[model samples]
Target: MNVAADPAPAARPLDISTFREGGSLNARLRQMHEGLLERVPAVDRIACALYDAGEDLLKTFIDSTRTGHSLEGHEFRLSQSRSLSRLATSGDVRILDDIPALVQHGEVHSDWLLEQGYQSSMTVPLFDNGALLGMTFFDARASHAFPPVAQRDLLLYANLINMSISSELAALRTVVASAQMAREFAHLRDFETGAHLERMARYARAIARAIAPRHALGDEFIEHVFLFAPLHDVGKIGIPDRILLKAGRLEPDERQVMQTHVELGLEIVERIIGDFGLRHLPDSSVLRNIVGGHHEKMNGTGYPKGLAGAAIPLEARIVSTADIFDALTTRRPYKQAWTTAEAVAEMRRMAVAGELDPECVEAVAAFAPRIEEIRARYPDED
Candidate 1:
């Protein structure tokens, strides 16, 4: 084995400027992928596989070389792939100089390389504090392309990629914390309990995960719903205390006034976007969907915009079930807490009656024990 050489001056210096400004991990990775191709013409393909440690699987998440290649959803068991498992444990960059030699030797790694039509390749493991996070692959069609010098430079790039992931995660936590503060502000004036918010968010995530396969939802979408669900009732902060805190059931006029909370929520989100100057960001459609359409019903009788089934955003639909289920199970000023069986039964009835999304309701029901655990964990203060 040839000793790996140091990074050459010709190799593009790993850029950390974007990391300082808190750029997204996915965006930075894409730039690195493109940069690798531009910096080394020998690189015919570049891909990233994120490790799902909890599931002991690897997912091909990002690929610049194979656009629309159906590799987005591909997953592999780490236990089954000896070469990949070795790479994970060793944390060393594997430089395959001759693909045909490995193939002739009946190697599994060669089988995979030959499938992708590559003659030479380099696999660099991405690690953070000794734990394997993922790996980046650089493939070429020409032999002896991934020399020792190339491996060294790619190793530097992989380290930068790991740092980028950490930065992105820190940024995401900041965003989530700020959003949670907004929810807490609303909770001060509304009937929402912290436990309610916690349980509802979990339920929303469960529903999203269950429907991900059928609706083509990804892990990112599921995470967004989980993070944004707590803000579904954020607009209630704008409602008048007399109406929001009424002891009895709301009157006709009071109900109409209460319904404006949805609109108020949208306005609040817009003003927040403006205040923070985040308007130019990839946009606030996710927040708007949860705030604006969470109350919309399937039969078009729901308010604010009266969006019917399919017209309502799926994110909102998922939250709707979560919010309603929590509301029914938790005691409020005007109503006592219903039993688990009672709440689930009523939600099931609403699903059958076309009032709630049946699929979402089913998903929530399927995770009943998890929901109960959340409720127990975050019980209301005495």
Candidate 2:
């Protein structure tokens, strides 16, 4: 097949630095598409579809030239388009020389493209480590514009793009896995026996969602808070084994040492970010406030930090209620789990005595039934 020559200057060597770790995936994909378009001339339109392996379909993730365009948000079933579908399913690059022939043969979805002024096009399937990841389509208004040389270059660029995406996915997976391991280690320490890190994370998320409306907490913040909640007790890692594993109540000195866990947790997170060189680092102050100040009394008697009232971060406040509520309702070696009614009464008392944030306590009270449902949904980890 004679694909159109790359009208732009020779493509630059792929730079790994162009692909950054620890950023929003959607933003990264959009940036990658724009970068590709700039390097590949004769490409007036670019549409990127990310394959959903579970769904067995290509969902358009980025469409750069979508205004008055027919290809925007187009869903192409793997069973419908013989050429492009086969390319995606088999992880092959398909260069079409005769667009009209393919359309007539039922291999191309051209009705919409024809209306949008797209003529000849090249479809390059993106794959990483033997798995199909997605496909990129470049189209122009002129028919039979792409040649074999251009097709080869496009395929090479597509492979480069796939490599970049694969690296990003690997980095994200590492972050998630590290977070999980940290949570498991923490669960072995204390807070709630039989209740694992996953349950606490979910509870924190539920509470955040419940309070989001009143506090104007954005969805992204709520999501981050949920994931970060598991790390609230990570500072316990720094506490001496005796204090951390102690089976009985602690003396004032021991209690002070134990309270240092808050600072320890913040330091641990800071170290993790530093080790990974993740930029922006999610404002450790908020997380530190939550991890350290969650135990603080509303009256300024809390340990590690005497932050009181509105001085505490809202995410920390939400997590404080969730963590305490979960602790109260779950059995532990030091104490038997209180009945739901008893737990509610204690929370109410705390609220009245100004030991806890009134609004947070009220939010937990309203979420009581939903909290029970969450507990039921995720039984204590065995």
**What TM-score goes with each of the models?**
0.65, 0.57
Clashes of each: 0, 10
**Candidate 2 residue runs with Cα over 4 Å from true position:** 1-176, 179-194, 281-286
Q: What lDDT does candidate 1 reach at residue 221?
A: 53
Residue 203 local lDDT, model 1: 78
Candidate lDDT values, in order: 0.73, 0.65
Our tally of clashes for model 2 stands at 10
Per lDDT, the best of the predicted structures is: 1
lDDT by residue (tens digit), candidate 1, 252-327: 9999999999988888777776666655433257678999999899988888888889999999999999899988
In candidate 2, position 21 carries an lDDT of 45
Give the per-residue lDDT digits (tens) of candidate 2, residues 216-314. 664445556655676667777677778877878898999989888887777776666666665344444555666767777777877667878888777
For model 2, where is the 10-residue window of minimal lDDT? 66-75
